[model samples]
Target chain A: MQDVPELVAQAREGRPRAVARLISLVEGASPQLREVMAALAPLAGNAYVIGVTGSPGVGKSTSTSALVSAYRKAGKRVAVLAVDPSSPFSGGALLGDRVRMSEHASDPGVYIRSMATRGHLGGLAWAAPQAIRVLDAAGCDVILVETVGVGQSEVEIASQADTSVVLLAPGMGDGIQAAKAGILEIGDVYVVNKADRDGADATARELNHMLGLGESRGPGDWRPPIIKTVAARGEGIDEVVEALEKHRAWLEEHDALTRRRARRAAHEVETIAVTTLRERIGDLHGDRRLGALAERIVAGELDPYTAADELVAGLTDGA
Target chain B: MQDVPELVAQAREGRPRAVARLISLVEGASPQLREVMAALAPLAGNAYVIGVTGSPGVGKSTSTSALVSAYRKAGKRVAVLAVDPSSPFSGGALLGDRVRMSEHASDPGVYIRSMATRGHLGGLAWAAPQAIRVLDAAGCDVILVETVGVGQSEVEIASQADTSVVLLAPGMGDGIQAAKAGILEIGDVYVVNKADRDGADATARELNHMLGLGESRGPGDWRPPIIKTVAARGEGIDEVVEALEKHRAWLEEHDALTRRRARRAAHEVETIAVTTLRERIGDLHGDRRLGALAERIVAGELDPYTAADELVAGLTDGA
Candidate 1:
């Protein structure tokens, strides 16, 4: 309900409430979303986005919490956007995870928000970048996006980040499972969490082997480092952070960071355009045009492609 | 590349190879797909689509196989589109399941195809209805769409059916899980498979209670029936078929079948239109316009909404 400019100003002044409100606006797809985004536009592009993702039992939350602690220790303003793509329910199901992250609750430099994609118009794909932008504009030096599951959406969300960290535990058949989940291609830094457990070394070795199998890297290319960590005990997390920094440095050196950000922006713009157009098409459902076309298709008098052509023409002509 | 007309003619004449080729074209998004869809248009709208879905261990494939046998016993031509949304690998990963479905392989009245969403451009959403169109045109009186997971996509595919059948086993904590998965809202008929198991009655009772809790049906509304079936032994399969037929009759009597089919066609048209626009946007990536807009957004000179507006304008203007 606050003015967009006032909210953006407060967010930039390091008010966590304002930051949370901005993200809520994004998640709710508020009518003032455009004004808020415009107000925050110049304030963004300052934060480094790191996406942490893996299977359910691989300690993604613990690893993310540990990373948050490490970043806070380094005197950086950090934001964690915990995204649960699998849950249709929003916020309530993630209350326990938020409680686990309570160590940073009182810290002014750390802001945490949990998002669910079930009721969002374009799901996580459309809402996440905006949420990240809100955090970036709120003066967070590092933004961590943690996803709950290992589905296709998780991989996609992770891939949208400037750096993607994939966590695996020992003896989970994770190496091959990661390959099957298509996370192997998106990870810039691989972390073997729960290192104190047995078979950790073997898991790391298998992951290393799998990473090397088909990828032929040219000189100057970044070879993602595998870091082992016992996140529950806060062990080996610094090395994970170090690997992330090294990857970021490599990306910057090769100008891949600019290209990657551009690609991510392009995807965001495309998703917004497509989502907006889809909404317009949905609006046409109340009109008889789309219904008549559907009836014709159902009556076997028109093919869907031809009908789609007519619909597109109508949309463009109206525009 | 066989000619589209010749392939459609052969497919309508009950040639399984032609049907397979047509589905392949849909899956591949072939250059001649428009021609094929136009050719298949007049022959579709005959097959009644039924979607079968559930969790991985719920014996969905077995139930589907039993249904195929029941339909074949009735001397009706049937086609099964087994969609796997979880597997990133295509037909190769589903070959084993195809072997499980081999009972109907030699039957001239049955056609089976396993599709994976990983490599497809528009995923299962865009490709599924087209594949269903192909099967409908191939003279199948009944089409069963069986998905291989309990994720959001499975729920979506099932909801697209004229009659959605939700399968559950006895002892998997399935009653509550089904509610959480949003399947309870979509099923027109519920099947409690593995009825010989110990908790069969309890599962059915729990499901019935859950289904009754929030729903306020009117006097003439179609109340979903829960059937117990030991699909492995073929027991209670006829009841499931009868339930499906009754649901179909109810749909027809209420004129809901025409409305459902029209709604499905509208969805198909919208998906095609969006997919075509996305391809055009992808083509713009090589032209530097999209890249330029992305650069401005990344540089904080533009917000994604404004960038998206420009992109949409370009697309519509070009159109």
Candidate 2:
């Protein structure tokens, strides 16, 4: 159990073990999370975050591994957070994906971690940003947040990135599925992965059509680009990386990066605030006050609104 | 708009339109929600809540419709709340499912509504209970909450029910998929819908084995039964209904029903309290204080935890 300052100092010195330790603290919601966050606060905001998200079997892991290689080849320290919001059992379900990413496991400049909500309060909304900050502060020039599923949580996580890459596979009804999952609007770059498969061109064309159907942008606005990739063979990945770099350049040119980071920060703060208050409410359960109110609610003597009013008053008054 | 008392009275008298209006008010989080909840307080708690949850294409809608028919045969008023937590666009994605449910639309004894998170604070956790309270107060003898997708949100909603039924279709790797989705432990009953499909028996057997692998229960504990149904043709629905009734009886005999309801009430209250605090946080964003804090965070001058602390302090002080 190292002190927060020592752990953070080692992380800053490019120690992967130290970096992994800091992330573990944040991911587990360790009691010293506040100290760790405070120590890392001044060192964050340097890393470029790119979120890779899509449904299962879209080759998200393979694409992420390819991107890691691309970034590392250019001499940039990279980190990948393979987040699985769908799996409550955390690391177990993502074991196969981690094995897929094991090529980077031995690289000193690459860090890879898998995150699940683990039934935490505020779920991924509360945890992912903290982990991202840990990586950002650890001197990772680029952080890839690859999420497993295209549920609402995944969409929210993807939108937190400076640039989001939405992936699709051909012949899966993925164009309509992506639109239905609401990932169509959140992507800065779209990749029709497994390009060697049938209907790859159709998938790309349909995605192009869907992106065009979104709100029309001004001349200076960045249009999301669709790239086709056969990630397993590492084909067309350089183009994907090129698209990412272009999007990043556009963001910097437009000063949209700062605004996006601020929005992300605001969301993170709100999630933490709500989670803090929720913890207090959980404490009320231990003191029997919440239980008493719940009993009354079930007895038909009190409505939930009135019971909540009392609980909120208790929280504020105690504060 | 009609007055709250008039609406409650009409709902109590089994006026379907009045009941629908009341639910709409709660679902929308109308300003009059507090008044409506207060009015409906004494009339709730009589309905038996059963949660039906599974992945998409598992015949959840068909099974739900079948249950509605079986309950109607017993002359009990029934309501179904088809909740889709994954779809941010609410009613549009659920429109087809509603059409499939239109067979009961003309029946005065049946009420069906589709609900989505709609980007609401506290999400389905906040809205579902309030909606359920409205349905319970509206003279419905049974309320079925059918959720789309087998994600974390759906799992949470299912666990909130007094009797949760986890559904599966044969030959979809559904048993393992259900386990990965974390729905295995939440079910009070399991149904293998589309039982006419191949591997129905295998699916049931695998589910039974998986359920056995979980922590063993005592002889007095209620074992969740796996029922097979060809839901589209309304086969084996009577057995499903019987299983639900037997579970309910066991719950009452063990006094677990009261505990479950009280737990549900506690959760509802906590959600409301969190949501109320979150609305205050949202107000801070309007006042520019949150924006200022976010800017500082993005600048790496402050950590999100500290920002959240200050926000929470302001909330409590103002209260």
Best model per DockQ? 1
For model 1, residues B84-198, the per-residue Cα lDDT tens digits are 7553222521232544566776688888777766465578888889989999999999999987546676678778899999999998999888888888898999999999999
Checking candidate 2 for backbone clashes, the offending pairs are: none
TM agreement with the true structure for every prediction:
0.87, 0.82
| Per-residue lDDT of candidate 2, residues A88-207 (tens digit) | 222521223445666776688887777866687878878899999999999999999988646577689889999999999999999998888898889999999999989999998888
Candidate 2 residue A98 C-alpha distance from true site, Å: 9.7
Stretch of 10 with least lDDT, candidate 2 chain B: B87-96
Instruction: Indicate the TM-score of model 1.
Output: 0.87
Best by lDDT: 2
DockQ of each model vs. true complex: 0.64, 0.61
| TM-score of the B chain in each candidate versus the native B chain | 0.93, 0.91
Misplaced by over 4 Å in model 1 are: A57-74, A85-103, A171-177, A213-217, A231-234, B57-62, B84-106, B213-217
Report the C-alpha lDDT of model 1 over A204-258, residue by residue, as the tens digit: 9999999993478888878888999999899999999999899899989999999
Can you write out model 2's per-residue Cα lDDT over B1-319, one digit (the tens) per residue?
Answer: 6599999999888787788789878878888999999898899999999999998888888888899989999999998888874522224212234455767767878877778766778788788888889989998999999886465776788789989999999999998899889888899999999999999999999999999936689989998999999988989999999999999999999999999999999989988898899889888886688889999999989999999998998998777
